[model samples]
Target: MSQANEKTDWLHALLLYGLGFLLFWEWLRPLSIISDTGQSEIFILFTAFLFLLSYFQLPFWLSFPVKGIAMVYALHEMFFPGSFFDFLWLNYFLSDFSQNVGFLFDGRFDSLSNVFRTFLFFILLWLISYLMQYWLIQTRRIFLFLLVTIVYISVIDTFTTYEADQAIIRIVIIGFILLGLLQILRIQEQEGVSFSKGRFPVYWLMPLVVVIAFSSLFGYIAPKAEPQWPDPVPFLKKTTGDDGEGKNGNGISKIGYGEDDSQLGGPFVMDDTSVFTAQIKDRGYWRVETKDVYTGKGWESSVRDRVMFEGSTETLFEDDVEVEAFDMKMNMTGNEEFDFIVHPGQVTSIETGKDVQLLENPLTGKVFTQNLGESVVLDNYNLEYESPTFSEKMLREASTEYPERLADTYLQLPETLPERVGALAEEITSEEDNPYDKARAIENYFVGNGFVYETTDVAVPGENDDYVDQFLFETQLGYCDNFSSSMTVLLRSLGIPARWVKGFTEGEFVAAAGDYREYEVTNNNAHSWVEAYFPEVGWVPFEPTRGFSNQADFVSDYSDDEASNTETSDPAQAEEEQAQQQEQLPQEEAASGSSSAPFEWSMWYTVVLIVIFLLLCYVVLKNYKKWLKRLIISKYKKRDDDKALSEAYFRLLWLLDLHGIKRGANQTLREYAVQVDQKLRTKDMKELTRRYEENYYRGKTNNDGWDEMKKLWENLIKKMQS
Candidate 1:
């Protein structure tokens, strides 16, 4: 083999490895969007390492241990908190492995721990990396893998929030190049032509490269046609009866307040259409209704008993709560009308132009408007309500003793609810001694934890999955519904009376009226929150969503010492302090003139570290052959014998080939020696070839001045280097 052939092989291997990595990347990219599989970058690095080992043709005995160490490191980094050499991680891995084996036998896949699941994922990636290498190198066929990669990207792009526009372009470029190279290799093999004979196939590859580049650029700049077909996802869902309605009647719902709460989960699209506007001095959550019974999937009312009322109001809260009377007017804006009135706080009285009757569901606190035995949608209405502010001191000292009816209605959890949910709730609230603190702890858990506030790309629970359990442990990314529902269920699991309430957020501020502020509420403001019932303080609203702040006010009475100790205990006070800190941050930065200097330096520091790592890698890869040559020369120089002479002679031939000496496929050893002697202007190659032939082909063990032959081999290597 000549240097040209060796260079060609190295180039082909690098290209194949690159294409294979890109294909694997496509498979891993969707894990972050469609599921809870984080740490995709680590998986990508592991796959790249596997490909590197294969490219070097490392023996399994050496490579397997290296891969095992890498896998252990990845597991430790992702799931454990300890030193790399700590034995505790090993113990935990073994425990998870043993338990998962039992789960596998019982076919309880969902019960598997995340550590075991990640282990399985690593094993799967190992298998895939091996398969990719085999397809790229041994068989010189990757069409099936490429095709599957395209299909995978397409399906994920259509079904999830991931945009695959750039991915498609990348696949096209890589797929074409892979196919072209594989075809070149195939033609070379069939015709018995060495890559050295053609010198890298520039004539074959340049045209292929040109065609691919031109086509990709043209396709990118060309005007694309609109989608020819309607989206089939909805049609397919309807056909398969998966139209956001699960087996237990709980699945994805739309963004606005709807009459049905039977199904809830999955992603929803935002609707910015205006719903109504209110003229009021204060902003608060507009309550529509509450659901008491949680059916493992969603909320529903256990009873439908109705009580009729006139213009006056029904008692919504206890009399001990402090209240302030306020009057507001609501004007409907959207075409879609509803019979229920959206009111803030407890309604004291309602006045409308049309004669109407009000029927309220005591079980659900949903008030309906009726006129002449028929439900009516009021275009405009005046509401006089008393907004109650609960005393935090009273709530903290509130009794756990609940009325039987309230406990039975609010503390309802399905039998199928996972035990982990209750355990997690207890874990979150274990430090808090009072119900108020416990509720605040659970509510704030979502804000500081890894929970994400996302509207699209949310997962719908499977048939056997509980909605709250899925949100808490699996996909911690969702909108208000997920957070509120999970908190409510967690509260119920802890023997607290809580219900899920859905309504509108205080909408965007419009303008200031004469004595009040005018606000415009849109369907985009449709929200849900948790309401835990305190024995004496009534149902208090809690905002557990990641980005949303609770609007209800709480009055706390604390001594100076208590205030100092628990300054951040009040949610509203904490929010106010956070706001004050943010307001002061700019001033503080200006005064010090160095507040942002550390952050700026840290960014540059990270960039420099990354650049250094890449530069080191480049240096190692570029000079590795020279290092290997030095290592070989040092090893064989110490042994001066016939066997060492023969081995050193063959290694010299490889080195000479790397230095561009020609070796024809049909050439004998003497012929190759003549070519090397002509190139290096030395007769040392001929002498070494004669000695090698004598020792290897004739099986002669005579040393025959092996020292002289070693000198000749070293001389030939030195001349070739010059």
Candidate 2:
């Protein structure tokens, strides 16, 4: 073999083994490194072996599609969590720009840019590989080797973060292999290694078999799928002296109820995952709002609704329920559509609440709702959920009949306030309108003004009675919490029934399989909006924070297109500026735009595929000419008979073993055949045994013996099928 031929010969095998190992390594690593154990390690080893076997039979090119699909699915699950899978297809095409896309709500193009950029990057890399291979075929140099290695290492480290799951790791590994192959191809071309079409070899089947076997093994042994589920309850809110009934070290109360733990609010720990989930007929605030009278450690829900028994009436335990003109009904059924029912606090009455018959649960309060067809009366005398859970009375009640608790909260306001803040509120909203209109006007003012939205870093809360004044007049930026709190207090100061409501904004719905729409809620998605009570209109929500008004009419004022276009233009414009500077100087060298070192085909499979493809093409286009030249020049080009016999013997033995025939480790070919015939149960086995004997013991010199032996194996296959 020529020097060039020898140089590129090892690339295929080297890449195949390297990628197979990488796939296994990635699979062994768990989401959290702390979870890694012996089980994952053993599985990885087995999987790698299976892959090796599968690749031995299949073409390197064919294995990529299956692997690529699997990798993409796994990686997407790891990074984006809830929202990640919804836009998975975007990731496939826009890998390069994924990091810079920002949040979905930030801007549309900002999100999509990464995905598109990644896809473009991959394409460019592919093109580079093609060019590099074309160039490298003519020359090989030491600098080339070092450059290739350095580039490969840099690419892997830069793109493959620890958080990336097994699938993405596989992609990275496979990509490297493909690039490496192109480099090898380039080297081969440069070294002037020449070969005739007839001499070209095809090992596509070897890798194909190995990859298939590996994938199958992985699937069979893979662990059961586990869907992410929320913890049953939010982090325990308080660790008071443990009451004997309580399990934790806190003695506050036997029953875990009333308010969240009080020792220290865990900014990290979340509320009960299920707290936000309830089935309601209509969308509204989840009445977590509790503050008997704001004690200033942040407003909290003080009263706990007693859980009513199944099919009980609200009349049983009503102190007094607020009456309304129109009977309101809310129901909590099983985990169906709209799993959680959330409403404004101070809900004095219940009617048409489903599955809740009003029987009381001693522990959790107000668990059930009164079931009154479409309308139930609020026990106005007692003011329990629509008094008389099953009364036939058609009495019209005023919507303003609120419980004392509700009235007290609405009327509540901080004792101290900056004079300028109150003046500003009054100035923004005229006194001619009702409290509801005033509240709306104030909300509109805050949203319309130059107040910014973001979580504030401020620690001082009691600086002024009018927190809104401080925010508006002093600090300009605060998160949704700050914005909503300021608005709530201001509305209360103005005699409007305003309260802070905590819930998440609706996330984009992902219509996955069937009619199910998966909702992905994140910490970034948690939000607070202000609810202002109008005597006639009931309670209405208003988000006062700029760029995030809760009103439906509040459209995004920021332009996504402009933001993305401007961000994308910065680099291009900079390059253009540089080019202009260079243009002014007559003798200056033209500016070269930034170009990444081209990716060479590093994958063994891809290299193997390219090699096979080139071989096949050569065989088709120049086989006859090559054959003539070989016949006239090197007569030894034909494979050696001895080598062919050894190959045929080993192949036939492996084929027999595949059919369930056992072969002893130390048995020779002739000995194995004799053993096969003695144990043979069918004519096909006997024939196979005879063929092996003829090829091995009889020294059959006919060049066609290998062909005959192959025919016997085919017959055996047919017999097995029959």
Candidate 3:
């Protein structure tokens, strides 16, 4: 018996590990780079780690800690760094808790080095925990195995909200649970510990049924919870560039510890932080960078940094000129209060609310804070910047005044240029007469030709002076930065002042406000475009980025019909009718009424209906069983007492009904009994009727009577069915 128990325990543990391996395999498979070439190496590493975790077996105490660490690690990757660990821990404890103090500490401590460290620590912790339990507690190994399996699963679920979409993980977890139950059942088999081993403890199935029923109910009724926003408390924000290192409020040095903080080489001064967020009616663009002066390396603001006029409340320059209105606002996410004015470059007037004040720059008339508070209110104001026309004409005419440093840097060409690039440029721009026309010709050429837009990781700096030559002639794959950088250098070689422009393109609109949207933006939306100075126009925007191109024909000629067809049809049709015959047919209705119903349910409607009906019948039977179980049966001393007689009378009547007997509506109990007895030719009919009278009047039904009645009724059913 001992040996059998030991074997069963080992088998259960192995099964549990096997189940874990399946779950781990699933987690790795969908996410692994091995599945798709586009996936990152880091993703592949993670999948491997998960596989190892599931394949290996450890004691309950050890597995629990390892699972906890794994869950935390997963959460860490999902959320902002160091943000979701506490929640992960909470989820872990909700699932399992069984670890030695030292083991727990050791497991967590060893998690410091790298990804593998956590796994190693978890293994050590599990081994130590198992050792402690084996030597000190001396508990049954079978029970230990059972406990470990339960704890490991509970921990996995608590930390990760398992979705049905991840079917493999779900199946694996379910397998572990079944294996654990099987182990417990095995122990009971040897020891005769079951509540009703002979009867099969059919009630044991009740819990699973109840759980599944509830799960099905939730699946059917639960609504999809949409994402929501937090509280709308107005916050003050100090404006900083994408790299975060920008000038402070006092403009002494860059502030806010921006993305370029390392480039700053030191901590930012607090005074450099300015309250830039302003309360407005809508969203508008804030022009933080103006690339005017171009050296070969980069662009900077022109030397004319003087303010034009004192703070003017009006945004319009002239009274009669019709102006385009672009109203906007900002929602700050930090705490700092101010009552200063805020306006875009085209503001014309002021409309201050409460204790707000507008302090314009003495030289340029640009707005700033007067009291230097955190939160501020800016009213109507009119402003303007140097137009693209003026910037271009100035660049063309002022050749002698050009910065000396910009000569070699911006105009430098590659030593070994591909002659094809120059030929391609010349061919594309052969029709255009001037430099501006030629530049436009080059941009149009790329947009119309076989050029593709995509991001690439390999952007090594050129060894020679001509980076543009390398990009245009050699590697054709690169991101927005590469494209614009190449374009700028090409234009400059033709004596046009061009520079790379780094800024986000237009943002996605927020329809709720009946205008554009905000807060939906993320870090990935940052972009790069090119700015070329024309003699007539200052610096015209030339967007060669992926999504911002103005060339319409180059984009795939996708019609609404095409979109509909793509969505509705199979891939085969998409190939056959590539450009036409696009239409979306409404999807066929599901049997259960929802679109998300599995295909099986739609295919087997009759079977599903039958199953549903059976389920309803079972529920009604279960409820009726509860009422029957509530009836108090008692033992009788007499062999044939009034209670037994009464039960026998009812049993006979019930038997008649099972044999296609139906009592007439007009017949009383005694009458029905007489008719039944007459059909059956029973001699004890009168006595049975008298017993029924006694049962109703004297109330003498007990356990013996109920048992006799049940036996007789069951026999009647069997006979009728047969």
Candidate 4:
């Protein structure tokens, strides 16, 4: 091989393996695999293997389509959780700016940017892999760079991950594989190898496995350290920022609650992971953080002040506010440190095993606790709530006097909120006189309209879009957060004070003793509900979400109103009238964009199909020579024994040439066979040379035993290899 070809081969090998290293680092370092248990690592390994196989089958330039297609899918998954499978264009990202020809520079690409972003990501992965490979291989100084990178990531992962669940094992195994690939490339460079000539040698793989085995054994026996860094991941907030429940932890929550991702949040998935178990009576949802500030992205709890409370006191309800009182006790689980999931009512007194700091928003009665030490035994806590008794009759007549301070804090709205939100709120509450009626009107819109209440997959709002506005006027699909946050925003838009509250649901009533009821609350029961505050009535808990028909006396009010509307009408054709009214609501919902066009998913299966297709291509490339030889054997199979002898003789010559002992162009067949006999130090090819001369020049048929010639041919092949 020429020096230039050797240089290119080394570069190709370096780029191919080096890119694998970078991709592994980018994926593993930033994210925690504890929840996933190395799921992301498995995916990385699969993609890398697929990538290398493609490198072997196609020329470097065409390899992009093989990997780039999969990357586009990944990018789609990032922007919209449920949409990696959605294809062509999902109208959400097709904003005004992205339609231009420039693609990246104009910045108005909106959702369309995802396509370029993924393509650009693949390009970057491709370029950096090649660039690093070429630079390192050219300098013969590649291993040190990879070695430092491996150590850096190992140390970071060591210090960063909280659980550290078998991640080091993955890292160690990956290091061995990478080192093996690097050395294999160096070996190829030494041999001046070319792929088209024949099969690659497998001799280097033995040492690779041996080294990996020893390294893995050492890893198993290494001494462990008591981690001094934070127990929780440090860069967690950034990593989980996009698809996370901010305070609650990673993965989807089922009990229909999450950490304020959005009003119209990402896909709702059920996490059956048990969040906690609660023992209580007077079933009501737990209220933790009340997000008073609404950014288009999601809800934010602006109440950062922590009031240190001890003994029988915590700043909860104001003295003047009247409420019914009830005492209760419960324990919090260790899914994460308990940040206080309390009922909607105020805590009169509380106790805990760990020293706790109490934080409360008196106006909203939303409370939080900071645990001093990581306690595992569901630390026992007791508290009395100054709860309120409410009926639709009492709430409608209750005073709407706005406290100046309370009004400023509770009625907060995002400034970028569209005009349609306030307009729609007014339109819904046009016939209602009181704030209670107005709140009910907005809540009923979600329950009675064509809105869907789903826990696993919810509507994803567009960029620069207000979550509440999107939920109300556009896509009427979501879980508890969507329904509750929209109702709160609508209530605030109508001058009614409402806040989004999150915590566990009252939970399934497991067993009851005397006055109290025992309930089991899993992470699946994490729920969000709205608190619409009335001046004399205090903050009344409202279950605005459709599927959750409990935790409120007011939820049944809308059902009653629907029934009473017909009874009071005294119409002869009441059934027909009710059916007509129901039909009108869904029609209005459709006009308001409650249902979007059903997504026409491009053949997303094509990514998988393409992977399979490329794999088949690799298989064909790997075995093409063998298949071709079989074809040649069959072609000569029908002929006589002479042709078989000639075929065997030619194969020996080809093997010799493949092994770089090519016969000179000017050499006759006799001369070549004689030279091979000398190289083999045997008389094997001398008899074969005499037979070939007779067959070719004298046209003499070799009727003598062909087995003897075959043995000679086999010996010559073995000799040339040695």
The per-residue C-alpha lDDT of model 1 at residue 97 equals 94
Per-residue alpha-carbon lDDT of model 3 for 471-533, expressed as tens digits? 465545445555676576567656556655443333333333333233222223344566554
Q: Which rank order by lDDT, best down to worst?
A: 1, 4, 2, 3
Q: Model 2 segments beyond 4 Å from truth?
A: 1-164, 167-175, 185-292, 295-297, 301-408, 416-424, 430-434, 446-480, 503-527, 535-538, 545-722
TM-score for candidate 4: 0.45
Tens-digit lDDT track for model 4 on 165-265? 35456655665565665666666678875554343434556677778878888868889788778644446645756444522232343344445454346
User: Which numbered prediction scores highest in TM-score against the true structure?
Assistant: 1
Model 4, 490: alpha-carbon shift in Å?
5.6
lDDT of 3: 0.40
Q: Could you tell which candidate, 1 or 3, scores higher by lDDT?
A: 1
Off by over 4 Å in 4: 1-28, 31-62, 79-103, 106-119, 135-138, 142-330, 333-378, 381-418, 422-499, 504-689, 705-708, 716-722
Among all windows of 10 consecutive residues in model 4, the one with the lowest summed lDDT is 566-575
Better-scoring candidate (lDDT), 3 or 4: 4
Give the TM-score of each candidate: 0.54, 0.35, 0.34, 0.45
After superposition, candidate 1 runs with Cα above 4 Å error: 1-8, 32-49, 52-66, 69-90, 105-115, 150-170, 188-203, 213-245, 251-260, 265-297, 300-433, 436-722
The global C-alpha lDDT for each of the candidates, from Candidate 1 onward, is 0.77, 0.42, 0.40, 0.59
Candidate number with greatest lDDT: 1
Clashing pairs in 1: 250-263, 251-264, 251-265
